[model samples]
Target: MFLFKKNKDLLEQYTKYLELCAETLDIFRKAIAYSFENGLNEHFEVLAGKVHAMESDADDIRRQIERTMYEQSLLPESREDLLDIIERIDMVPNCADHLATLMTLQRTPINPALKSEIMELLDLAIESFKYTKEAAVDCFLKMEKVKGLKILIDNNESLGDKLEHKMIRTVFAENTGTGEKIIQKDMINQVGEICNLCEHVMDRIVICSIKRQL
Candidate 1:
């Protein structure tokens, strides 16, 4: 009974960590959108601070889980799976931090077309995080929803691909100055990379859910 309670507590902590990740992703998306649309440079700093806080929170959760496991002599049947999921969840915040830092360092307003593409990528990435959060929640209930999440993942991936192609075309066709073009390219790539990472985490969550079911 004590072991069962400890497992429940650990799962709860895991859920909280997922929620924090989702919140951090939302902040990241909004910060990028605001920067692109309103020329707000301060939002980037805010986003970075939030991501740092989220990372700290995730670390705390991880330590708590470790402590709980030790105290209770409890081990997950698939410790590696759980560890992987936790690491992925933590990675979301790290990615956000990277994006924010990149924006701060660049200190240049993005080209309109490139901004549009990045905004689209942020939207899709946020959506992917939403579905990932739902999938994580479903895990606790023993509900298998990988099919639904896979659909979202596919949709987001398609959006990312289209945006990438459009951005590349706009950059070269417009003959934008080489320096600015490179900056835009880097921004687009980072945003797209975030979406890709989100998809990877979702895939891992699907695996973790299936393992739990088995």
Candidate 2:
């Protein structure tokens, strides 16, 4: 009974970690929108700070859960699988924090013409995250739901890739300096990477679910 309680507590902490990831992504979305609307002003800086803070909080929870799992005495394979999933999920917020910190520090100039495409990409990335996050929760709560969610996550990643390519081509075609074109393209890639990372996480989620079933 005590071991069961420990395992259950670990699961609860894991759920909280996932919730933090959701909050972090929402803050990231707001920061991106604010930056687009206001051009990375003081208000945007505040939003970025919130994103970083929430991500740090999530990291703390992840570490706590990891330690709890180690102490719970679950099957080695099962424990390793859960730990791997948590590590992969951690990448989503880490990417968000990295991108937010980069924008805050570098202050890259976003070209007016690319604003629409960039916004669209950002929206798609967030959508992908929502589905992926849901699927992740379901992996532990309801294993059967994962396959369906994987499809939605994959679609978003595909759309993001096409849009990213179009934006990159458009960036270079503009009559700007080569250096600026490269920088803007990198920014677009960073945003699109969110979707890619989401898809990557879902792949592991699906595999883990399957392994559990077997």
Candidate 3:
């Protein structure tokens, strides 16, 4: 009875860990939008700071989850799966921080040739993470919903990839200075990578779901 109750408490902690992961992803999504929507001015720095803090807090929770799993002797399969999911989810915030830092250091105006294409990629990338959060929540709250959310995440990711390629081709075609072309390509790659990270995490979430069933 004591072991069962202890396991229950650990499970509750697991749920909280997932909540932090979701919150971090949402903050990352907003940070990306704010960077693009308002431009990287003073206000952007404030939003980025918030994201940084949240990511830090999420990291703490992730460590706590790890410790709890070990202390309580969680099943190895579920433990490993959950750890993988958390690690992948961490990439979302890491990407946001990297992108924010890059923009702060470089004040390159959005390229006219790829502005619309870039914004389209941002929307698709944000949606991908948005659905990623849902799929993660579904894994915890409604395991059966995981498969459907997985499909939507994949679709969003596919469209994001196409837009990324389109934006890149547009960037190279701009007939700009070589230095300028390189900077713009780097920016586009970072943005596209956020979407890619979402799909990567979703892959882990799907695996976790399968482990849950087994």
Models 1 onward score TM values of 0.83, 0.92, 0.81
64: Cα error in model 2, Å: 0.8
Clashes of 1: 0
Tens digit of per-residue lDDT, candidate 1, span 1-214: 1223447777777777777777777777767777767774666677667766776776787777667655555555555566666677667677877767777776766677676567777788778777877775565454667768778887888889789878877877776688887877776777777667777877887776776666
Q: Where does candidate 3 stray beyond 4 Å?
A: 1-39, 140-142
lDDT of 2 by residue, 50-147 (tens): 99999999999999987888876687777777788789889888888888888889987466677888888888878887888787767766576899
Candidate scoring better on lDDT of 1 and 2: 2
True lDDT of residue 63, candidate 2: 93
lDDT by residue (tens digit), candidate 3, 85-187:
7788778777767776666668664565676777778777777777777776566544767788778878877888888788778878877888988888888
Candidate 1: regions farther than 4 A off: 1-6, 40-44
Better of 1 and 2 by TM-score: 2
Model 2 earns a TM-score of 0.92
Count of backbone clashes, every candidate in sequence: 0, 0, 0
Worst 10 residues of 1 by lDDT: 1-10
lDDT of model 2 at position 150: 94
